[model samples]
Target: MGGSATRSAAREVILTLVVAAILIAAMPLLIGTYTLTVLVIYGMLGLSLGLIWGFGGILCFGQAAFFGLGAYIYAISAVNIGESTLPMILAVLLTAGFALLLGAMMFYGRLTDVYLGVITLVVTLILFKFINSTAGPQYVIGEARLGGFNGIPGFQTLNVPGDPGAYIWGDALYYVCAVALVIVFLLVTWLLRSSFGRIAVGIRENETRMALMGYDVAARKTVLFAIGAAIAGLAGALFASWAEIVTPTLFSLGQSAEIIIWCIVGGLGTRLGPVVGAAGLAYLEFVLGQQSMIDNTLIMGLVLVIFVLFLPRGLVPAIASLWQGSVGAFGRRRPVRRMRRARHG
Candidate 1:
């Protein structure tokens, strides 16, 4: 049983890597930079939620808070520093630090699951309102003006590392984002199969049991939460570069809700599931946005309801189930056919 399980896992990993390679190789030739860049950003956002909610069993409703925090940090820092290299690093670090502090407060306080979600939502709202109110010139952080509701614009965009002057845009930016997504995906996959990951999942499954086993449940949860935030921060930084602007909308309730929807729709728990979900739905939304007659929000809401009612495990899991069922049936039939042939002979 152990050997079989190992083989199955190995096969799954190889298949995931191969598929990722093929997609990366084909995306440059098939899609424009704008479309590809947006997909990459969405993919990272989905991954952030998928890691926290899917694996850590922490449903963070304020994931957008970290995302916005990262964007604002990057924008402000880049504007002040006149280069993106340091600002990008600061964005990720600050976001992770904030998550670590927030998670520590929540986990150590022994907040219940519902309360955790509520607190995250409230935190996001507070940030949104505060940032939205910062329309005055006094809200400036060095060279970067917090354009209040209008958002901070004209910040330095991401440039090549070391050179600082040469910008990565267009097709080059697409490749960078694509490569980043692939790396993040592979890292998350490896972590999920690691001992730390198993322990985290164990805590999610039965916190009491994991606690009794001498695991520091709160600490583990905090680390996972921070990791998720850092991933979201990376996404946010990329988004700011892609759009050449950062807005409080990044911290809006709507964005938070959408992130949750992506994770749920894509089939959470697996590494690639959220990416698949985020990209598929985002593209759908984009297409829907083009049609003057169709209300995109209504369509999305309906799709969510349909998925929850009929396909709770989500698209990836549903397809996996069908594949397994087909394989099982085929195997069973082969044995019966072999037995019949032997008897007839």
Candidate 2:
């Protein structure tokens, strides 16, 4: 029995490995640079949520603030310095800084799940209000309009030495984003399996016991929050490069809700599930939106309602279970039919 079980598990693993390899090998041929960029952004967004809500056990509703902050940080800095990489680095740092401040203040004050969620919402709304309302003055950053509601356009694209930018590229940015998505996925997966990750899991299970066990709960939460924000900031930079536009929408309540939906609709606690869910949903939205025959909002509403009702854990496991059930049902039917034939005979 043990040997059979082991062999069955190995077969499952091999099947999954083969499928993944084939899909990856054909991705460049199957998907264009634009589509690949969108997938990369989706993966990054998934990783961001999986870190905070999934692993850290923090239901952060303020991620869009960091997302917007990162984009603005990159855009504003690029306008100032006329470079992309520096702006991205600054965006990460600035996002981490704001996250540390917000997390320290809220977590240290003994805010629990619901209240913590509210605080995050408030933070993002505050950011949205400030940015959306404060644009339009002649505020100049040494000659560039902060651009305000109308974001700056005609920006210089990112370029590396001995290499071309995305605009002047042979799928370089797509490959860069693909590399980043894989690296971030592996890094976050490793983090979730580490000692720090265990402590996070402990906190998620029982913060009181973990705090009593000599762990600085607030500190750990704050640092993890910062880390999550930094990752989200990096995602925002990728998004900016992909869309070539940044807006106050990034800090809007809707934006925050989208991240929450992505996290919840994707299976929480598992890293890759969310990545797949985010990308799958995004791809569906994109494809449907392009078709004149379908109303995407209706499609999204139906998907959200059905998923929330039937598969609260989201699409990944839901689809997996459906596939398994189909196979098992057929097998069971074969056995039942043979039994019926024997009884009739």
Number of the top lDDT candidate? 1
lDDT of 2 by residue, 1-345 (tens): 979845754574466557645665678797677887777777787778778887778999888888888877777777787767777788889999999999999999989889999999998988888777657766666545666677766555556733434352337777777767777765675576457877887787789999999999999999999999998898887777667777788788877766777766776666666777777778877788789887877887787777788778766555555675778954445444322221111
The residue ranges of model 2 lying beyond 4 angstroms of the native Cα positions read 1-24, 161-170, 292-294, 318-345
How displaced is residue 225 in candidate 1, in Å?
0.3
> Tens digit of lDDT per residue, candidate 1, span 128-218?
9999999998998887789889999998899998877899988888878888888887778767767888787788778999999999999
Q: Score every model by TM-score.
A: 0.92, 0.83
Question: What is the overall TM-score of model 1 with all chains considered together?
Answer: 0.92
Task: Count clashing residue pairs per candidate.
Answer: 0, 0
Query: Candidate 1 regions off by >4 Å?
Result: 1-14, 28-30, 329-345
Number of the top TM-score candidate: 1
